[model samples]
Target: MEGRKLFAGARLRNLRQAENLTQRQFAERLGISTSYVNQLENNQRPLSAGVILALVDGFGVDIARFAADDGDRIVNDLHEALSDPIFAERRPSRQDLKIAITNTPDFAHAFLTLQRAYQAAKDRMASLDDALQHEQIDALPLPYEEVRDFFNYANNYIDWLDRGAEALATEIGLEGGNHLKLGTERLRGTHGMSVVFERGTMDPDIYRIHDPGAGRLLVNADAPRATQSFQIWQQIALAEEHDAIERILDEARFRSREARSIARIGLANYFAGAAMLPYGRFLSAARGLRHDIELLAERFGASLEQVAHRLSTLQRPGARGVPFFFLRVDRAGTITKRHSATRLQFARFGGACPLWGVHQAFERPGEIVRQLAETPDGERYISIARTITKRGTGFRAPIRRYAIALGCPVAHAPETVYSDGLAIDRAEDYDLIGSSCRICERRRCPQRSVPPIHGQISVDARVRRVVPFEIS
Candidate 1:
């Protein structure tokens, strides 16, 4: 495949300015001509391979720093933000947005921050309206929202906590096989906590409970084997890695005590997943299998959701896997869990696009549904979805169902097993999807639930289509 030309004039200018070097000085450091540096900084010339090498060797600059296409991320986010109803008629063009981002990145970032604050405030107002209807207005910012924002800002990867978990896994010898037995043994030998499986002994609502007085960890027998193993690992993380987890929480400096407590649980869950799949082995296995979730689950004794969630956390600096976005949605399309190493952010207020294959996964239980999706800003992704069912204790007990979706950019599709036999190059094969209907700009979508926020609605007595009115 031919490589695309890299024209990062703004980034080059920013780097030079940060080092307090003039164009001639920067040229001298890079061993390049002043005119060539001027041309590169003005976007008249693309960054050549020799210049990149010079920049790396002469200044010891990290190559990955320049490799990031921050302009694309900024453009995508700006497009989403401007799709709001307030800018329905005065949205900026794509070229204008690119110029704004390239010429003034700081201003673009400040604009994005203001837009995020607006969205958050809008969400709070909606919640307040709902509360007013029920005559109960609680608070401004919820702890759950704070926790979600914390994870989102961190790109869903806690590097220190992940490394700590990896070290703990090495200490416990959790490598070769039978990870479940290894976890159980570690808990019993190191923590002096006996594992007990008691059916109907604990509340059906709780999956695992630790009894300090009895010196036992009680797991619900109704849970699956994978769940049982995960519960054991979670308890081990809470008991053994309490100090490390507390240090992370302290460093986080969450706004509220409740947020800190919730974050502590989240960090424990991260450690449990890391301990169960131990970074090196899991990454190697994933690459070998081309990230087949079921096969990986079978190999690692993990659930499908666990395997998918683990894939999103493989951003360990030098040993990163393919960046993926993972999401779990219930039947009503409510997103229960979300994480993105990609640019695709989930809508904060509503369900995902109805056109997405994740909604179809519920209809076909246990089957992996594959889709080629294109976002609003022309980004293409290969998405795979499968329904996961959780059985209750008794025959009459209600069963819970959820569909998990995992996706990556089309450029990375070749690295996944789900992309096999897919017509990735065919544009017609890709479904045009967006983050949400309110923000979508697709005018004539048959599955649209509501009029687009940035579209003009045209109603006529003579004409009628799938929708009640035409969007202009």
Candidate 2:
């Protein structure tokens, strides 16, 4: 592989054009003839080590631009898209797919977009069919999903809001510990807002509520310390950063008023998290502690879920932390929250892979379960999951239980404490995971709920397997 030559003609051409260099000018800089440069740019000739070094030294081009081609990503996405049963017979070969992606990237993207729309439409039709049986049809573009997609496309980080929150934290003297007290003080002093905790005053289900007319913010008396502090910061964000929040909302152009309103709340929650864990200090602490969630939660007075969510938002340019995927699931295996900075994407309409450690975390609450997982696409990740329980006040009160999972690519596993005793190289220790049963291609999985789309199933009367039928 090392001796193999690299041919990235399109990328080389794009880079040269970006730098406003012509074939003659580029050739002079790289100590090559114009014809040779043209040949390389046209991919008639493969890129050599000398040319790569010359490009790096002469033009300061990022080496990764050539090393990690977007064509590969396009190919992977295309392969995944084509895996649907609809195209089972017409699926292109790997080399053919690579050629399509490399030669016609725009057409490839258009095809991917069409496939996504088809999938979305299929999902909606299935829901509609179900609704016909139940006689209930829900609205399109669900508010929660809309907000989730908004954050997903933004990579779970809003630079402006993050920086503003950090500045506000500093102004409120939230540094050097005691963030909850500082948050409370800021809400009271800066916003002229009073924090009130009273049992049975507000809705029993509502955690926090603000009454602008009364100039008071009421929180549930039984709320945890982290929840109380988060509510305080949320209030501050709505009061002090209302203009900024609205500005982003305007730019977002959300389709519905409900979505805009929900997004505003989500943005405020983002601000609260950022304020509670100031970006600079939190990143420093995370690196120093090797991203120990428990230690960070204890040090920052945050919940494990909060720490995990914050870890996924460390996509700040030039000071980025490890790209992590974060997810939260309830006891019934419903994914409550999800964001991935890595290549992994959660199921858009169904439960996650049963083989995932997050599902198992419910069996052993308070314990961090780690697993090396490989997706169907051959990407390996190091995942860690733990159950988070929120206790209720009264004897008969309902308690909230959720499990949060955080993971990054296997290449980053060495930097985290969870990987200390694990053998990442052992295939037996690695769990084979996927997005969902319907989309997963593992034919022999015992836990599969449904046969994969387009899969052929055969049943033999004499054979009894874990699954009733064999899938091919």
Candidate 3:
């Protein structure tokens, strides 16, 4: 008996074409024969569990993607096979099906075989359900947050950035990057500046451009807090070591032209932050200031967001500081930029957790609010959030709304303004809002559109809502 194959072979082929890599090159990376890679792409072969894992670990393919459309078909068929139309029908939940894929693929394979036979018997049933309209559903993309969360812990890159930022700050009076000016001899004679902007014409994405004439580049004021500080950091990175950054980003199998371009720019910025906020020096200052953002900003001549953004980038190696992540969001709860040097996961498609102080800061206007949160792993983090509103160049122009969140490990919580005995252990009762639909676990959330991955919900006719149906 045969069933629908993963179509993964087809998707791989598409990705390969977009990347412009030959089968041999792809095969070489996997340490497999070109023939094997060819056969797999042509659908003449099925992806083994080990091969799937290898693709995820080595090539950065999201394992959830492989389990999605390809695995779903198999699961649907298994359920149909296990069902008994005449009597005591047994139906497996999607969770049970997922466990089979994650922990026991061998069992999954056996179930698929049984499903094929059962489908043969149910052929009559398929014809009877004549109201069916769409038989072929386009496969949905993988859960992006899950994949990003995986990478968030892969290395100590964040610590390096934090340490590097501090180290450079200590050596260069903590105002190393601030001295740069646009289109000046101070830049040309020693450090120079360049100007660049985002693609659109209306809103400003005006950022610092790299200038060959000037010794140093100028950062853009129009960028978000993370991007602004990062550009400042990038300027610093150019003046220092360049090898490590080139090495790390070189390994990516970027999805498209856009991804590669963003990755290039993003990695360079990461290196720059690392260069400025060198671990040891920055951590010392952080402890000295007790992570007081305003004081740090004044001491370093950085903006409020600048110091906070740096506070989160402190991931060093053996002599590590508290791992922290930072994010900037607007009034509509749109996250413009985020960078993590910690275990906390950032939503790729949506905003952030609503119960956290970051979202609440919008209500306080210019005031800073300290809060705490717990992740799925039960690790607690202390977060300080505030609203930073910048006026337009003219009264005619619209004012911009923004929020900054700086967070650190719970052990360092007491030092930060966030850990004020807020009982952030578990807010199970509060609504889980501001997250990508793909990775969120809050089935009872009033904001979720699509149910979270593997979640099952039963809508009762008895209830209606002011918000979306809550998932648990």
lDDT of 2: 0.82
Off by over 4 Å in 3: 1-178, 181-205, 210-233, 239-245, 253-257, 375-379, 420-439, 442-453, 463-472
Please give, for residues 261-347, the per-residue lDDT of candidate 2 as tens digits.
999999999999999998998999999999999999999989889999999999875578998999999988999999888888887
lDDT of 3 at 39: 86
> TM-score of each candidate?
0.77, 0.77, 0.56
If both were scored by lDDT, which would come out higher, candidate 1 or candidate 3? 1
Off by over 4 Å in 2: 1-139
Question: Judged by lDDT against the true structure, how good is candidate 3?
Answer: 0.56
Candidate 1 lDDT, tens digit per residue, 383-470? Answer: 9999998876887766889999999999999999999999999999999998888878788788889987777888998987888888
Candidate that beats the other on lDDT, 2 or 3, i.e. the better one: 2
Candidates ranked by lDDT: 1, 2, 3
Q: After superposition, how far is residue 383 of candidate 1 from its true place, in Å?
A: 1.4
Error of 2 at 253 (Å): 2.6
TM-score of 2: 0.77
Per-residue lDDT tens digits of candidate 3, residues 1-472?
0133443566567557766789998787667889988988766777775667667777777444333332433443344334343322445676787546544444665554444444443553566555335353212212232123223433324333344555555555544345333113222433444334333332453556665655345454545444555565565565553564445445444334454555555555666545445556567888887788887666654568766666665543335466677889887777776767654556544566666788889888788787655654456667778988765344465677799988776677777654555654555522233335545554455545566544445665678864345554
Output the lDDT of residue 340, model 2: 83
